[model samples]
Target: MTELTDRYVWAAVRTVPEPQRSDLEPEIRELIEETVEAHLASGEEPSAAERAALVQLGDPERLAADYADRSLTLIGPRYYLAWMRLLKTLLATVVPIVTAVVFLAQFLGQGEVGAAIGGAVATALSVTVHVGFWTTLVFAILERAGATDAGLEWTPEGLPALPDHSRHGRLPDLVASLVFLGVLAGAVLWQQVRSVVRADDGSVIPLLDPALWSFWLPWFLALIVLEAGFAVRLYLRDWSWAAAVVNLCLALAFAVPAVLLWSEGRLLNPAFLDAVGWDPAAATGGGWTVASIITAVVVLIAAWDVVDGFLKARRASAPVPRHPVLVDH
Candidate 1:
């Protein structure tokens, strides 16, 4: 058979179940070969015959859905609940929080009621569209990829004897983590380009050391990216030893830059302090004290997160007891 024949067969069965694919693939190939052979026998060119056979088979996605005995719908019944839950969660948590932040920032800076309301409305709508679009796109892809079917097969044996709720990572947590990270990264970069804090001389003062942009800031962002990656993995899989280990590594990674910035006493902008009315001497001492406290708090939180991950993973993996049934007295 021609390469086209193989491609056609693969396309048809790509989204079908694994066990079913083994049988369906060969059947599809056989049908295509027969159709192509019959066309060739009628004096059609080889290429033409292959093309005709594939065309007769119809769209690959539809064929796969037919073979799987399911409807070819975007976000079908199997994944519809999951999709709705995620959408509602994002709308409730990330959207409102982001909108509120934007409104407060605009209101505090511009001191205009109408402008703040308009900005907040605009931001809320934008966040909603992006969140809804991407979340739907992902779930749609999962539906087409037959992930829903794989998850739909359930047996009593597959159920955990005692479910560990802590280990069950919710989609909201993942979405929130990603949203918060995006906001944080955006704010960091935004502050650099245009300072939210300004001096009396009309000079813009960024919160962080602008010099750190060349190195330290990138390193800090990289750690945040790593943490985001872990969050995604946790969203996909249950908590485990490997995940906990990586969480600890990430905790340490986050602590390194924080410690360096604190020890070096260059974490915050001196100009920002002056903008806030602190004298030079007080700013120096106060900056160091604040940086030290913030660093300590961040390190402690990271450490606690690592410990929490391990504890949750251990709880998830613990063996559940099977109690014996008592005879009727």
Candidate 2:
């Protein structure tokens, strides 16, 4: 009935394997109740007795780990190295590239180098925090779930004849894709309120139509979310035919909204063209042409990504060729 008792019992039972939980939960609860009652009988205050009983149980996560026979560390030794490698790879590669891109975009759009650099630093820090947090959280969960054992067992027969590093997906690529998508989503929403591009008269020119906020932008953001999801899937599954197929579908989903917006001539602001010094007639015609070309390019890239996925999956799934052993005569 006490908060401590209820919390402790819930935490302990939740970590137990689902099949055993139904049976173990009541037993643990009974034990806790018995311990609390004994403490109270010994002249301890009711609240203090409950607290003491829960303390004797120790941390709920640790107790759950004990129940599941899992290690309580954030990442177990079995997965620690892999987690470190991935974390380092993402921080080293994706963070820098994304930071640079953000800095340049901000600088070009705002024409303030100092502000752009500061913004870039802030963006980099945010990305680093998120990447580190999510990666550790996932590994921690995997550790708690006893999933890290998949890599713990090693046999000579299981070893690759030649070290094949190319089979695995690059962590940088996945992280970059996710980060870029996030930045793009933010920029899309930002454009609705603040203009990134400006005219000489000091009038702000938004990159996207403000009217999009009512209907089209949400769909556009949805596509971005879908793309981000695919990026995560690619990271988890590596290169696979199924992943490639889904990637292609996502590409099509992205292209559809782009094409519709372009056809309707609502994707980009007309003010943006004026600010950039394009003749009105020429800019209008050219914008449509460019949009059509871009749509085509997106489709091509999607096709290529699908093909690339299948190729990588094939290479990864292929059996390593064994060389003939020559026995001494």
Listed in order, each prediction's TM-score against the native is: 0.44, 0.41
User: Runs in model 1 with CA error above 4 Å?
Assistant: 1-169, 200-203, 279-288, 320-329
Model 2 agreement with the true structure over 1-329: per-residue lDDT tens digits: 67767778888888766898888788888888898899999999989999898888788777766766766567868788778877998899989999999989987997655566678989999999999999899888877666535653555675435433332536777889989999999988787667767777876778887677787788879889988888877667676667767776776677777777776777878778667754222322224344454556676876786677778677645555564222110
Tens digits of per-residue lDDT, candidate 1, 267-305, equal 777777667654222222124343444566687887888
Stretches of candidate 2 above 4 Å error? 1-169, 198-204, 274-289, 319-329
Per-residue error (Å), model 1, residue 205: 1.6
Error of 1 at 238 (Å): 1.8
Model 1 vs. true fold: TM: 0.44
Model 1 poorest 10 in a row by lDDT: 279-288
